[model samples]
Target: MLSYTGGFVLLAALLHASWNAMLHGNRDRFLSMTWMSIAMAAVSSVAVIALPLPADAAWPCIVASGLVHIVYNVSLVRSYKRGDLAQAYPIARGSSPMLVTLGAALFAHEAIGPLHAFGIVLISGGIMALALQGRHVSRSSALAAFVTGVTIAVYTVIDGIGVRASNGQALAYTAWMFMFYWLMPLLFVTMRGLPALWAPLRDAPMAIGSSVVGGLVSIAAYGIVIWAMQSGAMGAVSALRETSVVFAALIGRVFLRETVSAKRWLACVVVAAGAVCLGM
Candidate 1:
């Protein structure tokens, strides 16, 4: 079961990195993120219709998770704007699992075995190394990325509890959360005027395509994490999911044309080892 969960979360990590790369590569990241949210909400709407409504207990979590995700999106855009993907992405993603581990123990009464705890430490350390080993990232970007990481941990714990409260309808909880989370981002984008918001889509075919595909990838990635959390320890699942930083580093070098040093590649190797520990 642990191996299966680890494998799925690793897949989610790859998908998560791919979408982040797409967002980082776009000209107007905020607008691109808005479009991606719309696509996610649209795709999730179908799942919402098909799945049973999450139990009443899950609604509060769904709403809370949605609000937190808004902060996450805004912070991520700010972080990406201020720094390179390889740096900002690792910091934003790497800082979360530790927070999630503590939050899970405190709020959800989830116990972490010694091996799992070690794994979380390794993953977090490796991720931080990826950020620190490369060219220096600005303080503002690092701050924004840290804020983004906090939001990720918050929503992750919320969704973890929420999925269990979903009365065996984890899919329903995930779908509803995704569907409503876009409302604020959509409104924020619309305030800039429809013309401004739609300009990227109108002018850049690649932008529009990436936005749509990113949305799908984002949803799938998160859905897998949520599903894994249903039966797996939230902390372990979170630690595994955040291995996305490794993929993000690779994507940064290859696609985004960013610099990744040998030390950072070594950091990626450490993260993979951490993932192996979790899978044990």
Candidate 2:
């Protein structure tokens, strides 16, 4: 299981970047996210029907993490409203890994190897530098991004425990978690009215298709990481998942045609070096 953690997190990283790119591409970030969540809810509703119910012990974690995710998603949309994808994405992701890692050590009795610790530092440093570079982000955007990071850390830790308490029903817990998490976004979208809600998709079937694909990609990514948590160290898994920041930069450059400076490339190199250290 440890040996596969690298591959699992790598896959999660790529998928995470892809879905975030899709969210960034939309004209209305929050609505786009809501639609994505709706798609996730649809799929998850079906999944929960097939899976066994999780133990009573797992419900608290599921409920708590769902609330945290709603906050995270709101912060994400707000951050991106005032910041570039490259800047906001890194800032949102940068601090989370370390927070999760330290929390795991202190509260969950998880141990990190010296090498893994070094790698986490490297990854965090690179992403933070990337986040703080190349833009005049508003103070509010920075705060939103910082809050997003905190939520990411919080949910990561919560889910780590939640999935563990699932009593052979971790996947069911995940399905339920998605269903619960969708409620906040659905409410947000509904508040915007029915016509406004359907307008984006009414014109673009391709957008609908892409959003569905993005939602699925995101679910698969988290599914892999969540499953990995059962047998791998939570801190390490969280740090490794932040490799998505590097992929985010690449996504910004290619898909969005955003400029990639020498600094960004250097950050990517640092991220690669950190991944190597993580693997060792």
Candidate 3:
């Protein structure tokens, strides 16, 4: 990976964490997510218009990515509703990088050394450790989070590949994917028994403000990762991007007053250490 691209990817992670914290802090996650998605679509559409469409080979992947992202957003909002951001964020983000690494190894034939293998295991362990709730979590909450984890893993791997396959047209694909991805969510919110879908917009100014901020952060995050994929290895970019989980945990603790146990802190350290090893 190019040093510049890696740096941008890290910045993207920070932005991603910030937006996630905001969503977690919100009184209505579904409303925030819906607005965020709309904002993402609008911003991405405008930015992507400056570039040409991706190659034919990228379209299928782009479409598939969009579909997966819809599921990801739904799962994420549900996870946030059920669990603390610190705990749920770690598990959801922790699961992805390892899955991306495995995908790269199996399909892209990237050679994995013992250190890399060990890093993946440590990351996964750390994530699973964070999954345990404070013993007050309901069984249904646990189940929903687990299902969310699966969706996260699936979407992360798919997007990693999709970005890589964009072949230097990462921005175009991101724009298209973000635009297309909102379709399902929009349809669901409008048609799926939610008469209150428009309720959040009753406060147009606040709605617009939150949507714009959330969307801009999201656009920056996705764009930087796409650019990173163009110049760097997908697995490495994905792994580095997953660092946002740790950042989110800190944000949650400080801002959201979300509790973090010593074990969870240690887990975060382990994941960071693994990332360091991978970086070296």
Candidate 4:
């Protein structure tokens, strides 16, 4: 049976796919992403104020995660530029869990049982097949998606350790991390003159709407994942999170009207089985 934390992480996986689907439709994806980050920072500010202060030990991890998140965002943007949303998102999400599992095992010294290891393999393989299902993406885009996965792995392991060290205040630590998540994007946009940033918004009201909604969803999604990570195995939690790829495919079919093939549907089943294995 799936543990309660596993169940919650599955919930988070769905939310994660929802927000990313919203994001994929943005004409000015970078700007929409900026808006999402700004929205997250704004809400996180409230969380920081309302939640109890994180212990001093958590600060180091918060700082490290903030820096790493910049690369993650940039890499994601690059991935989008190179490939279609359906392809890019799955590649990034699918590749991440395996890397996270390995990182946890080697550096964090987290022990994984054989079943969890097989689950990670299934997830990675299924997602890889799903990512390659659609129109061919540029190699550069594929590389960027792979890099996004790596960055995700790094930050995830960092946050997993940091959250555990927080004792019971992991939420506050996450709040602070979200508060700074927008800094890198903000700086890049500002460099071209802040006016250039908002100029794109004038033409794309729908993108703006998605940004606001996606922003809120992403913040809550990560918050839930971080909370689960504190109690669950980071490797298991990370693998379960990638099941978002299955949801992404369905979202693409339903809302985006993209044609998803039957083979891809089978891949989704493989991904689901991996997630179930992790939960067990």
Candidate 5:
């Protein structure tokens, strides 16, 4: 079951990286993110109707996670705006596992075996290696990315506990969480008025299509991660999920045409070794 969960999370990591790459490649990331949220909210709205509601006990988690997710999204956009995907993404994603491990131990009482601890350390170290191998990233971008990672850790722990408290209603919890959290982005876009919202769509119709696709991919990726946490340790699952940094590095090189150093490729190998340790 642990191996199965690891594989599923690896898939989620790929999807997560793909969506972030799409967002990073866009001309107007904030606008694209707004549209992506609108798409997620639309799909989640339907799911919320079809599924049973999450337990009342889970409501607090959902609300808190929702607010943190807003911070995550905002910081992510700022991070991407300030730095290359390879640089910002690794710092943002790589910093989270250790934090999640600590948070899980403190808040959720999750025990970390020696192997899990080693894997988490390796993954985190390798990810930081990928980011720090090149010193081109601005301090501001690194800071924003680190803030994004902090939010990721906080929400991962929150949702991990919340899902367990949901009486096996993981899907319901996920649906409701997405529905609730994305509304903030939707509200932000709306407040900007119709013209501002429509400008991206009118100027670049392709942005709408990409945003819709990115939104679906994003929803699927996170939904899978949340579901996996229902059975897996939050820290282990988080460390495994952040293998997305490796994929993000590759995506940045291939799609975004960013320069990737040979040392960064070595970092990818280190990350892969860590993933193997976790899978074991």
Candidate 6:
């Protein structure tokens, strides 16, 4: 069941990349994400009402994770705006597993086996190899990309722990988390970017559709992953779920017409192999 669920999780990853590709292709990236966040909140809020809430202690972690994720979203859009998608995306994503693995060791007290360490190194290296184009990426974009990666790692590990603390109701935990998750972004938009918000909201139907699809895809992806974890191993589930990076790279190359150099394809293969090893 774990292995089968892991495969389903990979489909979830593909869905994740699909929506992200949609957002990346859009003209109004930030606005699309904001709309998506708003829609996601509504959808997840309904789920939260239908499902059981997470344990009380998990609430704090969910709130904190949402705050970290808000920062991540801001940094991610800024990074994408300032840099190429192929370059910024991988860097931001590649840096996360290392942080999550470390957190797993220190906090979860999970034994870091040699295979897991090697898998992390391979995944990180592969992502970096794919991202480093050495042209047009400014220092600021690079910094933002790295910071986004760190935030991803923080939120992933926190969510993993929070989900575990739910006493087996991972779906409910996720629904509750998403309900609060929408609050931070809403408040940020209302408080900080009030003027910019109305204009984007008024002008674009494509933006709205992109937001809705992105939000739905994102919620579904995480829902599959949380369910997978209920019957699967965390480290394996996490690694498999992140295979979205590979799909993202391929999508960027084929759909977005970004370069898919031999080196990057090779790196993607290596990372996929590492994920397989983590599962094994």
Each model's TM-score?
0.92, 0.91, 0.89, 0.92, 0.93, 0.89
For residues 1-280, could you state the per-residue lDDT of candidate 2 as single tens digits?
4666778788998899899999898777777777788888889999998999999999999999888878887888888898877777777776677778777887788877898788777877776666666657566776778788889989889999888888867689889988875685567756887676678777876776677788888888888878878767777777678778789989999999878789877876676566556545
What value of lDDT does candidate 6 attain over all alpha carbons?
0.73
What ranking emerges by lDDT with the best candidate at the front?
1, 5, 4, 2, 6, 3
Alpha-carbon lDDT, every model: 0.83, 0.79, 0.73, 0.81, 0.83, 0.73
Error of 4 at 144 (Å): 1.6
Deviation in angstroms for 89 in model 1?
A: 1.2
- Tens digits of per-residue lDDT, candidate 6, 38-105, equal 87788887887788777787787778877786777777777888776666766676666666667767
Over 123-163, each residue of candidate 5 has an lDDT whose tens digit, in order, gives 77786676566678666777888898899999999999999
Candidate number with greatest TM-score: 5
Question: In candidate 6, which residue pairs get closer than 3 Å at backbone N, Cα or C atoms, i.e. clash?
Answer: none
Clashes of each: 0, 0, 0, 0, 0, 0
Give the runs in model 1 whose Cα sits over 4 Å from its true position: 275-280
What tens-digit string does per-residue lDDT give for candidate 3 at 57-165?
7787788878888887888888888887877777777676666677767766766778778878788677656665367455566566667767755655566667667
**Candidate 2, residue 81: lDDT:** 92
Candidate 4: misplaced stretches above 4 Å? 131-135
Q: Give the TM-score of candidate 1.
A: 0.92
lDDT of 1 by residue, 1-280 (tens): 5777778888999999999999999988888888889888888888888888889999999999988888888889889988888888877887787788889999999877788678777877786676566447666777888889899999999999999999889788888898775674567656787677767666887888898899899999999999998998887788778778789989999988888888877887777667556545
RMSD to true structure for each model, in Å? 1.9, 2.1, 2.4, 2.0, 1.9, 2.3
What lDDT score goes with residue 72 in model 2?
Answer: 81
Q: Lowest lDDT 10-mer window, candidate 4? A: 130-139
